[model samples]
Target: MKRIAVVGGGISGVTAAWQLARERAAGRAVEWVLYEAGARLGGTVETERRSGFVMECGPDSWVTEKPWARELAAELGLEDEVVASNDAIRRTYLLWGGRLVALPGAMRMMVPVDLEAIADSPLFSEDARRAYMQEPERAAELKATALPEGRDESVASFVRRHFGDEVTRTVAAPLLAGVFGGDVETLSVRAVMEPFVRLEQQYGSLILALRERATKVKGPKKSVFTTLKSGLGTFVEAMQREIPPQMVRLREPVEAIARIGGRWQLKSSRGAEEFDAVFVATPAHVTRRLLEPLDAEAAELVKLEASSAVVAALAFDAERARGMEIPEGFGYLVPPQTAGEDSLLACTFVNQKFGHRAPEGGVLLRAFFGNRAAGTLMAASDEEVISRAREQMALALGELPQPTHALVRRWPFSLPQYAVGHLDRMRALEERVARLPGLRLLGNAYYGVGLPGLMHEARKAAEEALG
Candidate 1:
């Protein structure tokens, strides 16, 4: 039998195993094993079930903009189990001056699409409003000049170049924290916000490009995010069910990987094993360590030091929540500059975003705090963590009572922040890895961090490794 070893139990590893499993199911004649260091599957994609509530300690959904995850779900017979966000009240707020202000309707992820929306927003000052409006002419004038191609810059510089410092501080910084848990000044423009940059380059103005996009849209659009009926854990469970039970070695952690005698060898707690091929889907730093002895050059680019993420979700009593002055939207984001040292990143109205996650009449909100600021809370006692969560929620959602239920999940070095030059590094790493035989590295540290991105990498790995 063709022996294959799958290292890491995260979504990427599981998806890659499942893809290879399909090939064996199609009469390829192969045996595969998945090694998970932890006792359970679904690394960070954990969902805790309680009395009538689904508490997600990690990601909640996949943005529908990327179709790979959904397509795979359909293939797994999970089409009927899919659920989208509650679009009717689907709105996001940004914390400004300690107030939860609705993100202007026309903006998408900090890129202002509507000058009128900026004009209507109380969050922006008069100078900001004027600078926001005049971006197109400035961009057009800049576009008239010759610029070098393929130059990379930070997300902060890109936003500030067109939108000004205020936009970067208030909109981009907060939104970047909410998503990547990284400072915008370090995150790469080419890796993260390439589409916006490309649009500007093509049309000479983002406003002009957005105007054309809006004009061409002839009908209503679908909600941008989707999840499963039983929470994200359900997706993990479904994948586990399809994988051969004996193939998954829970509590078996891989220690090192080596390429020896035209085969890949993995040293784990159980001992050493050889495989015709191996996929290391652990975190980038883990992957780096595993490959360092075998391929130092490749490891250099694959090494990504991830950031810390602390998620604490608290539920309010249904009756008590009814009369509270909680913001009536999807919650708000706190910019780093305003949040200061040891500040919370953002607060999410979990129940408001997806009504199914909570019990009837109850309110559930989650706070995402990251980096050194989040580290302080993560190292604290559960009581301290919950207390800080309460304080943050109160500051963002107005005065609120103690939680009827609270959960704190600390994930250290979980999110990989793609900084400037990340793309060039990854490209070089891919080229180097391609030269090696029967080895593949899969994880969010390279291209993307979302579910769609991970699934996309899995598909590519399957095609490249198996085919």
Candidate 2:
């Protein structure tokens, strides 16, 4: 049997192991061993049940449009367990000038093609609106050469150039902050939000591209995001169950890796193991530490930049929640420029948006904190964070009542920031890693920092390892 070792037990690592197992079962004689540094297998993907609330420590849902995660779930017999967002109450908010204002409808993140919605939104000032209207007439100039023959300009530069400063501050900054937990000024447009950037490049204008897109799709619009019926952790747990217990090692942190005698030798705190192939699925930082001796350049590239984040969950009585007057919708996102006293990047109305997230007459609210501009918030004590969250909840939802239960999860350097020129760095790393025949790296740092994107990398890594 060809011995293979999979390092890091996160979703990426577990999924890669499962895929490799399936391939091995199909006539390839392979022995697989999966190692997780942490006690639990699910890395950042975690779900905690406190009182009657289901609190998601990391990401809550995966983008369904990106099919890798969903496809993997189905292959694992979790198709019936899938759940979609509550479209009936699908709405988001923006914190503008110390106030939580409803984000305009038909506006996906920062791309605003709906003039009617933009005109009606209270989030923007008259001057901001006037400036936004002049976007179509703005002169188009190539800021930098495309990364891969046709892509160029960072997300910040793109928004500033096309939509003006108001749009970048009011719309783009918050969206990017929420998604990447990074500063908009440094994020790469092509690396992070390439789809919208591509649309603008193709059509010459965002508004024009959106209108053309709306005209092409002739059916009832579908919600863009989704999760599992039980929770996203269900998917992770299922994958864990599929892998053989003997082959899986939890609470085993890998200390280092080296190429020994044409085979990879993995050293963990417990002991050392040699394998014919190795897949490193930890975060870029952890991956860097493990690969430092094997490849210095690869390690350096993985240590580029990352952001800290904190997710707080607050539970309140449903009656008290209803009285708070939170508008009917999913949640809200606060643009960095306008965030004030009780400023938060985004708030998820868990109970209202997902069923069974809370018990009867109880509401669950999740608030996200920390980004490049708001890193101090990540270091604040839980009491301070909760107090600030309650203040914002009272102002935005009018629910000043004390929370029935509260939970906070802090992630320092949890999110990798894909800044300008990140794609070039990743491409160079990939080319370098390709030179090592049996070595592979898979994680949010390479492709995207979302569930689907991570799953995609896992599947690709598994296929490559098996081949």
Alpha-carbon lDDT, every model: 0.83, 0.78
Predicted structure with the largest lDDT when compared to the true one: 1
Over 1-467, each residue of candidate 2 has an lDDT whose tens digit, in order, gives: 78888888888888888887788778778888899977888888988877667778888988868888888888989998877888777778775555667787777677666777878888778877776676555424321322344446677788766677778887888888887778888888788888876666566566667777888997887777788767788878888777888999988888888898999888888889999999888888888888788878888888768888878888876665666655678888877776664467788888778776888878788888776424666777888888877876666666467887888778878889888878888888988788777888988888788888888888887786666
Pairs clashing within candidate 1: none
Residue range 248-269, candidate 1, lDDT tens digits: 9999999988888898888998
Q: On a 0 to 1 TM-score scale, where does candidate 1 land against the true structure?
A: 0.96
Q: What is the lDDT of residue 86 in candidate 1?
A: 79
